[model samples]
Target: MDRLGDTYRWKSENVSTAEVAETLGHFSGIHEANVYGVQVPGHEGRAGCAALSLDDGARKDFDWKGLAAFAYQKLPRYAVPVFVRVLGTEVGSAASHNNKQDKVKFGAEGIDPGMKGKKVVGGEGDEVWWIPPKGIGM
Candidate 1:
């Protein structure tokens, strides 16, 4: 099989997938979650941004700015989750744990601007902003 070469060279510079996932899980209030890298302007690492999918099925995408804000508020810079991409569909959990609906799958794109305040599965109650953090300068 062809080697799965590192598609994101920038990711090597900083931040690990484990760290990203852990941070997102702690902040998003979800047990199962996945964090992936996203490319952004001016950022050194492609993984500078992380897209997190939670276990409860509530997804929210946060950028560096947003992550930093969360970090400042509760977590440290290292624990700050950047570039979150919320998912609309449910994500599965690890084998040891029950297969719960992953909410972090809902990225910024999945959320509709009109439904920002509306309650969605795996998301906050109605009236909460669903807009991606990056869209609003994080």
Candidate 2:
């Protein structure tokens, strides 16, 4: 693990979650972002996932397609988050007591709807967006 222990392996590439989060934070309407890795069934390594908090009143106007494009341009193919979780307004939902984003629970939750609960994100109406892997069907 690196200094932040935010590094993970995906597609035989070492991905730095902080780097991906920083790239995501640069996007408009994003207030804060946290990147982590989630296990994909039958996959060799963990897959990238990001949990983001948008600026006030930015949710309805957020452009997912545009974000995808921005990510593709700024990040490497393997570093781009495969799943995005739009978190709620509550601060505790995305941050911990020390004000640092926590990834333990989020990583465990992954992108599976069935794994989601009151503790995990992706509740009713909470947008969990996903981008298919390269050359894969939508």
lDDT digits (tens) for residues 20-103 of candidate 2: 999999999998888889988999889898888899999889887778888888999999999987877542465666777777
For candidate 1, write residues 38-127 as lDDT tens digits: 444575644333433445423344343554556446533433444444444333421113443222233222333454323334444322
| Number of clashes found in candidate 1 | 26
Task: Please report how far candidate 1 places residue 133 from its true position, in Å.
Answer: 11
Q: Evaluate residue 111 in candidate 2 and report its C-alpha lDDT on the 0 to 100 scale.
A: 81
Off by over 4 Å in 1: 1-13, 54-70, 73-79, 93-138
For model 1, state the Cα shift of residue 71 in Å. Answer: 3.3
Model 2 ranges with Cα > 4 A deviation: 1-5, 90-92, 121-125, 133-138
Give RMSD to native, each candidate.
8.8, 2.9
